[model samples]
Target: MNIIELFEELKIDKNNILLASPEDIIRIEKQINVEKRINPDIDVNVANNLILALKDYRQELYFIASNRILYTLFSKKNYSRHHFPPLQREYDAEKIQSFINQFLNDDLVLYFDQNLSQNKFDMINDIFDFKNCFPEDALFQLNKKLNIKLDSVLVNLSQNNSENNSAISYVEYRSFYVLLSYFSSIEMDDKIRSLVNIVSERYNANKLSDFYTTCISSMQGYVAFDPGLTSILVRNREAAVSNSIERSSSGSSSGMSGKSIFFIVIAVLKVLFLFAKCSSH
Candidate 1:
């Protein structure tokens, strides 16, 4: 199939298209390279797949980021009080998603892809094991899991882009910090501290400091999700991080507690695989 036809089959539309033209693709990629320059270890394999899954993975973040942010805004600018104000073509679908793509690509998206490859996923293995035969295996893992879940709700803040034109909402990040807490240590805390500092500075969001302080103060460790949920590119799960959000159709959220966080983690896992499935195709 030609590129245009392939994109159409992928259900590409004006709203989701970051690459409106060949030039757009090149410009987006240059943005990815800047991150690699800063952190050489970061694998930007997502860019390789961006061309492939323009509609695939987004790395899976767009759905989560967009749902939290724009759902209410896009629900209707038609309202007056307590509603999004009149948009001046600044908040259209393409620009909004594009903004998310650019913001995530910088340091957040690949950061997630790189981190997931870390040993943290072993915890998810514990969770996914479900261990029907040994239900405790998954049940065995809830303590650390739930703590990190608390951290996620408290720490994560999602906005579609840097322009500050999109909506910002509390979204769930990747649930790997439980691993740091489970195996608490100087190195883990230090690594996350560096990341949090960078993320906080880039986004100019203070919630991250909550994570940074908590994470370093003790082995409490913070919960941060995959920003690549709104990022571009694809990395081979095997070669990059072993693998890798919510809201696009997360349906709705109720009370958030350790119990709720537990369900959220599983939900995130389902979403991750959903993206993985898209990548496979």
Candidate 2:
């Protein structure tokens, strides 16, 4: 089905849907037969799906839109004679950034040192010029927000990874691993593999390798967090809270009689703690 149909079928609120440009909406609308104009203020049901689709297809869309914008800019007669616009006429970085921020709101970054290959590990040192490229303040915020412990080893690894791989592919792999390392069990692995397979098939990939390559190449930055365990945490948040409340209530009741509630509370707290820790990573 078309995007609009999918959205309508899912009853997504239009306001929750953010776009980088009106042109983007127009383009998508043309590609898909949207029976009615999407009212930004009234639609929200499919916001999650929309966000997921956009992220899963981000690099492809980003590259396409960037190239298109560049082409449009250069296609004009005075292109080379003047400086580039602060932003392109049809590009809205803020809107895109907002979408990004919203997408990442529910997710956390996970790091894995052991899963990284040696060559991949070393390339991090060569690519990123720390002084010129990365935003120090943003990086600091990222570290603080995600509880990422920045060290020479991690920095060295990232820089080296950036240098060794092709510009497009390098960032893609890094993003993939950054998301992948969060999966800790065979079940999560299966989910990832299934999602990858679905993405590959949707994109009409001929081989598993090709599908994986394209999937990562296209969707790198769009993936804000590892959804494997975090999704479970989100789904169970209310239940977790309810269980805690129940334990607390039980504790209050038992404290007057026996130590039953105290043990139950401790057990519940331990489980909650484990869930939180797993979800956080």
lDDT (C-alpha, whole model) for all candidates:
0.34, 0.35
Index of the highest-TM-score prediction: 1
lDDT by residue for model 1 (1-281), tens: 22222222333343545435667656645655664577564445544454544544342323322332232221221223333223222233444344334433333233233334442444343423211212233233444444454354334423324333112111213344444444333333334433333332332223223332232222222432332321111111111111101212334332123442343234334445545554576
Which segments of model 2 are wrong by more than 4 Å? Answer: 1-92, 104-141, 145-281
> What TM-score against the true fold does each predicted structure earn?
0.21, 0.19
Model 1 vs. true fold: TM: 0.21
lDDT of 2 by residue, 54-122 (tens): 545454324222332322221221234133324333544444434333432222111113223322422
Give residue 140's error in model 2 in angstroms. Answer: 4.9
Worst 10 residues of 2 by lDDT: 106-115
